[model samples]
Target: MEKDLLKTPIEFLKGVGPAKADLLKTEMHIFTFGDLLTLFPFRYIDRSKFYKVSEIQSAAAEVQIKGKITSIEEVGQPRKKRLVAQFEDSSGRVELVWFKGAQWIRKSLQIGTEYVLFGKPNFFKGKYSFPHPELEKAEDFVKSPMGGLQPVYPSTEKLTNKNLNARGIAKLTKALLPQLKGVIHENLPVRLLEHYKWPSRQDALFQVHFPTSIEALELARKRLKFEEFYFIQLSLLLQKDRQTVQTKGHSFDVVGERFNTFYAEHLPFELTGAQKRVLKDIRKDTRSGHHMNRLVQGDVGSGKTVVALLSMLIAADNGYQSCMMAPTEILAQQHYNGLSELLEGTSTRIALLTGSTKTARRKEIHADLLNGQIDILVGTHALIEPVVQFRNLGLAVIDEQHRFGVAQRAKLWKKNAVPPHILIMTATPIPRTLAMSLYGDLDVSVIDELPPGRKPIKTVHRYDSNRLQVFGFMKEQIALGRQCYVVYPLIEESKSMDYKDLEDGYESICREFKRPDYNVSIVHGRMKPDDKDYEMQRFAKGETQIMVATTVIEVGVNVPNASVMVIESAERFGLSQLHQLRGRVGRGADQSFCILMTGQKLSNDARTRLETMVRTNDGFEIADVDLQLRGPGDLMGTRQSGMLDLKIADLAKDGQLLQLARREAEGALKEDPRLQKPEHAATKQFFIQKHKGKVQWSQIS
Candidate 1:
């Protein structure tokens, strides 16, 4: 079989047998040679040089040394065994200690024999030592291919037992590289290659796997990053373009003067700068000849809904119907209720459609919508049903882009005579570079400023030791006629996390608040739809003061009365998620506070996260920090959320690169909109070849 082309079973790969193959495929989701090759390492280690015995501190770290074993001893009992070895090189001496699994090392090591050790270098009493370090004989020295720069692939505890480490990956790549044809596929234009100074595809692949120098590694990394960002930008713009062509964006002549007069005379409150800016942008898009594929992003409580309402009003005043789709039934009901109150005396028709509605009622609503009797229809995914149709759908606004699928988008488009202008909204603020790269196809408007009189939510970090204090604060808020939210992470993802802790948390709260009079509604992944709706409605109505929930409540169902949000074990959460939870509060007029309770022992990254939460309320700034702290895959559900399709780019650290790549892609699209010619052949082929994993990767184009 050709080395690069072979479809060898993972079991046949060097150093892997049936047992390890099972572990790889079952535990780590790794299968086949190609799958292993694409499994990029999560991190890398630097082993530039050997450390001096005198320089070794009490701190624990891996150290490389040339040493000979001077003495050996067994110290612990049979039940908990430990082996200790004394070593001395030409310069100084150190000790090697093994715990629990001592016999494996004892057999691997012989008295007075020299060996290489990799492990935590520690000093005890007066001598330098390594506790239970990885030991190998002197003959194994030549086998260390990763002596300097090493990539550490993500692994499970089960796989580590099989000794399938970085070298195993290198060996596999080595076997496969030569099998690749000499004149392998080239998917980048020659002009692009010259402008970006990119290496050939074969060279980049080989160098990325086993780079000979730092420069080679950097070149390989850059080529891959460019490809990643370019593909993502291309996908986004393509999707946007496709939507633009498909949707006619029926022209709406909204009488803004009346709206302006209404605002100037009876607006009642001052229009926030953000609101004005967003409204202006919306009006321009609605009136433009081309379809408006725009995304409106803002933080929670920044009045994004009002801007959306005003945009819908533009469509309504133009004598055309509009629709707003929310992810949940509760939110749809909420929007209907809000609109019914806001447009009480106006002729703009408003109706609600959800899965729970009676068949007769849904049919009537659908008929009314078709006859232009209803001006605006708000609902859950039920809005996409084939029977639901609009008479003159001029503007369509979708809240929370992630919740709706492409099938739904098509469903939405079919509702209109000339498909409505698309307006997408999100309460989450993504980094600018990422947004441009990801949503570049659509026009983007950001409401960066919060409304006046909306006080920033006071945030603080606490340890488990201050549990009583947190409970005290909760009690005070409850007594003050305010409600609280206790959010827990999903118990288990896909039977992956059945959080006994979730129910345990609810039970504990039931025990603590202790008063039978206090109503606490519990909601988690296990609950039925009605149960969840009941709990949410109860909480919304203040029938229940505190609602214990999972992150499911992060997106919709706004409560102006909830003022306190207490997140337990908050360190377990990412920065963006923490911000989202904080967003659940601060929506009401009463002063709001977010308490992030963590454990006493926190990792460095966790510390930075806690500090960021306490030090600022800026969502964009926090998004930047989140990107820096965590790469795209872990930051925003990139893998599953289907939003992030980056292959080699880091949205946080590689913003400049993303910007440059997006500029190039956008320029390329402008020159040849379809990328059908010889000039764009390479880029198009690259997208087809490389950006097809995980998500459909269609959203990028």
Candidate 2:
């Protein structure tokens, strides 16, 4: 009976009529009682303290006051009118003003009756007033159930216009809570609840919405957050278990000639301990006989490519072809070039395929790939097209994994009979907390250290006024036979403005550097693929002294001779993007520098981003700051699986809670892999209901 009531539409609630219910559904996505119940407050007010009219200060925040409505009148012109009431307590008098619902408020308000007014106090014309104050009869206010803390639910202007503001939503929640008394069954086992000393599920729901005190609110928040993370981790871990048990992967047990030769003869530098550890994890996964789906997270220039190439070599030794996919043509070509250089002495056959590939070349590459003659294939999205088939493809490496959608990545799985050992590579370091929640299903391996002999890039912030000095520095670097990259921001939302900026910057660079002494190549998204590649190759081959471009060079322009990166209007870029742009330099040993150029005026967030870029080169540290500034949603592109849409659990602040929840979830799954135990019945039922109709993208990763 309680479950049915919880599922009932919001219109059936006491204070929500059909119109209000429709508004709630459209504005807040509150369709049923369950949705409304889970619409937790963003903040709360302390109603236990009330100030007298005389005690209210002009600078005071939201305040509650006790007073009597001595007089009321309508003022101002039609459609611009407001109702004002002069209210007096024993000490002083203040005005209560209403602009929106004046007529209804004036009709309901009783003069000479004591009432409680709650709102932010605004001071104007040498007087203090409460605008659109929440008015309640003194007697009713005393008898009200919401006494200690007042929940402030999230609201919209449309909802506020329809009298469904935070207070209105709170009223609806208050009325609906009683109906959930017996309905909020415990999804977690009693043993777990007792072990954590947590409140009952029903009690937590009530306290979270209308807590009696701060202590109760904290406990309630913890319990709910744990439940959210626990269930998500449980679901992800379950998917991982199922994949391990059911999916069969080709065993690349023998690390034969190619891998050993590359390690002993072709490796340009010694592998860092972190890289070695990650490679070990990858090797273990590939040979476990279960489909390998692993994510390798490393800072930019952390040698993730070498690890991926070695993994591919292992697949080649196992007599299976491997393929690497990048999001852009430039990156694909760069990978192909780098891998080709590494395997120059070996007999390994590698091919590059992209939209820019000639028709004849693509046909040759396609035929070779199908006949198992191609040891490894590297390309952009073209690799996933149906025309591209692989003979016993054993390993698949994806760079910048977040740039591809789940469906796009899933296409690679269909390229072979059994899905290849999937390896996802990313230069953007993900915080451990976010990784657990975002890519929880995949086994994660991080290359935490950069390869030896790589010097940390020096970063500094400069205002636009310092442009001449920056240019001189660039010239000095160029005079030393090193190249420079001048990058302009290219935000998609304002492409025209960005394009103008890029054009203006490029022109200025050409005029300042001059043609004869300094040759500059420009690249942007609007450039033809061939033109962009030509410019990129010019920069790569040292034919161009300076490369003026947009974020197109952000991923894959490899120039060891390029040592200076000047990001124009650096404040316009994000933390991760700034780190990536800085990464473009510092690839070589010659003391690279990243100069962040910004305008004098900077917003606090923009300042933080620039400051963070100047502070450290640790990608994970920068990523954590990025998460705090831009939030989890924007940091991880919006196309992610819906798991990060957490209702109450904040990935930024609740790291410890997430860790605890993950450990508990792992323990639970270890005890009952299928969640079929009698003690786990509630958890299993809740997990199924929660995840119903959700596409499992874990398999693709």
Candidate 3:
């Protein structure tokens, strides 16, 4: 066997012809022999351990037993026909049955033979039975050292249809191992292998697929998991070091009149300690004359917007233009209005650009932006349009940064000769492990404290039995001159019959407090843009006492006077969404409340989510629990697929392992930053091969 042979098409393997090869390729993406070699097992079981019929107690437990079949018989009608066999050893006797492939099994197994049987045993009516136990002659089974762990591979029905189950896969792996001996090249460096006491690449692969013992399997798994995490950390660290050396940035050497004037005259309130700390970090990056790729994370109402505004002002004072990109038009408009009010008497000119901008205003704004008349430009994805050129764009602030794609952010780099400083802000706090893996290449700054004078929102859980009581509470809050939001989970009546249920709830609310006494504004995704905006504005302006909507209002809806958030079917929503909806309230000075209303029956995960919401308003804690419940993919949504390319490692469970991997990667880089040493060549080559065709976000940023 040679290196080229390992790369040979899997169809060349024995017992796998053209038809089976095609099915393997289509179903499992196994094109080459090497691909099949790396399909590791998900679990393993003891093969040597045997049990007697008298030792069986639990029906759910699988056991291996040594016995001889005394007799065999077929029972039941045509469709329900089954083959049953009486198996007996010196200790006891057990019945074995097969519902599928009974005729084939009957033909394959012989009676009056000493065979080793392995299967799960079930007990009913004081009798124990083994269903379709694996049958092999005692002498044949004894020849193979039959006491080690057996590998169980992940398989699909399509592959199983082609007679390629877990056992079949193990057989193929057993066939391939002989060829791979002395053929697998070492991927990790010699020093790393010696220091970690890890096995060679060949030994790890073989042991992981077919282990001789439990200890060997554990060592094999550790080696592979470490390799997976090490490469990711190496790539991120390399990109980060490259950015610091290669990308030059506009230096805001002095915090002059614009920043000073806003701080002195138009400052909204005293900055919180977390806000001050993050601002200090940003100031240091801007002053260093190196491109700043930083992420600012804070919970809702943590005053992240004020921090963004202050950073933009620093860019302005340095005689450079700045822009802020948001995920939606509503959010962009909110930023524009808030910043406009903050800089009312300032000399800096701010402009807004979104999809709905008028043609005449768009032309004026474009002209001003190109010539540097507009000091700061705030907009949605429209800021990335071809015509949206800027004059010396020094800083770019992205709000709800996860909503935008890498390519969209890359477009902002073309606005100037040099890439502008990037400061990404997210209100949904990310757990530490997720943040480390996801944004490891960038500088992370967390704003952990809310601004002073903001009281924590009082959260309560309620059942459907207290529907009238909850409505009365809402009425009481509204009577006190505050607005309320009633959020439902679904929108379409046809899709979720519960949409009709929500409509009935809405009708009841209207009927209870009718006419001029209480005007309610309803908004959802189905409504037209104008209609939705109209309703939102009415509620924001205090013209409407209550706003009924869906999760579209989860982000960017800032109504300071709103004090109550009544979430219907709260169990149906995730922890992050529920937190964001609750954030809509508690923005004002008055005491705020969030009522989580759900049915009596709740799932374990759903109950944990609701309890976490009620217990604390800490976004980081919620995010950690959410990660444990839904994993990184569902928590981060669609844009995280490319970034979280973990194959063998688990982010939630392997946080400590990831930290060790990152430290190892960093130590290696510190010793040889460019990996130019002969000893580092293997590690460098391994990284390139592992990350082929993948766009590294670190490089793009």
Highest lDDT model number:
2
lDDT string for model 3 (1-701, tens) is: 44487789999898788988898899888888888887888888798688887888899978888889999999999999999999999889999999998888889888888898888888978999877677789988888643479888877888787878887778777888888788788878888789889898889998998888888888888888888788778887877776655689889999999999999999979999999999999999999989899999998889999999999999999998999999998889889999999989889899999999999999999999988899999999999999988878999999987888878988998889989999999998898888877888889999999888899999999999998898898889888998899988874445456566567767877998788889998887777889999999999899999888877798768999999999999999899999999999999899999999999999999999999999999999999999999999887766556667665678888888788888998998888877778888877766666667774433322
TM-score, each model? 0.82, 0.94, 0.93
Q: What is the lDDT of residue 86 in candidate 2?
A: 94
**Backbone clash tally (model 3):** 1
Model 1 alpha-carbon miss at residue 277, Å:
2.6
Question: How displaced is residue 469 in candidate 3, in Å?
Answer: 3.0
Worst 10 residues of 3 by lDDT: 692-701
Compared with the true structure, model 2 gives a TM-score of: 0.94
What's the candidate order when arranged by decreasing lDDT? 2, 3, 1
Lowest summed lDDT window (length 10), candidate 2: 692-701
Candidate 1 per-residue lDDT, tens place, 1-701, comes to 32344346778776677888888899766677756666665555565567666657656566777677888888877887789888777778778888867776677677777777667777667666787676666676767555656666666666667665555555555665665646456666778779878888767866777677778788888887777677777777776776665445666665664355545554546778887898888888778666888899999877777777778777877877888899887677777887777666665678899999999998899899888898788888888888787788888889877667667777887776677888888877887876775567788888888877788999999888998888899999999999999888763443335367677888989988875668898877667878887888899899988898888887666888999998888888888889999999987678999999888999999999999999999999898888788765564443235556444567778888888878887788788777877877767766755546633544334
Task: Residues 645-694, candidate 2: write the lDDT tens digits.
Answer: 68999998899999999999999877877778888888877777777777
Once fitted onto the true fold, the runs of candidate 1 whose alpha carbons sit more than 4 angstroms away are 1-36, 41-48, 55-61, 72-75, 100-114, 132-163, 191-198, 245-247, 253-266, 433-440, 462-578, 584-591, 595-609, 626-648, 676-679, 690-701
lDDT of all predictions:
0.76, 0.89, 0.87
Instruction: Please identify model 3 stretches exceeding 4 Å from their true place.
Output: 1-3, 70-88, 92-97, 106-109, 122-137, 143-147, 491-502, 638-643, 692-701
Worst lDDT run of 10 residues, candidate 1, spans 490-499
Ranking by TM-score: 2, 3, 1
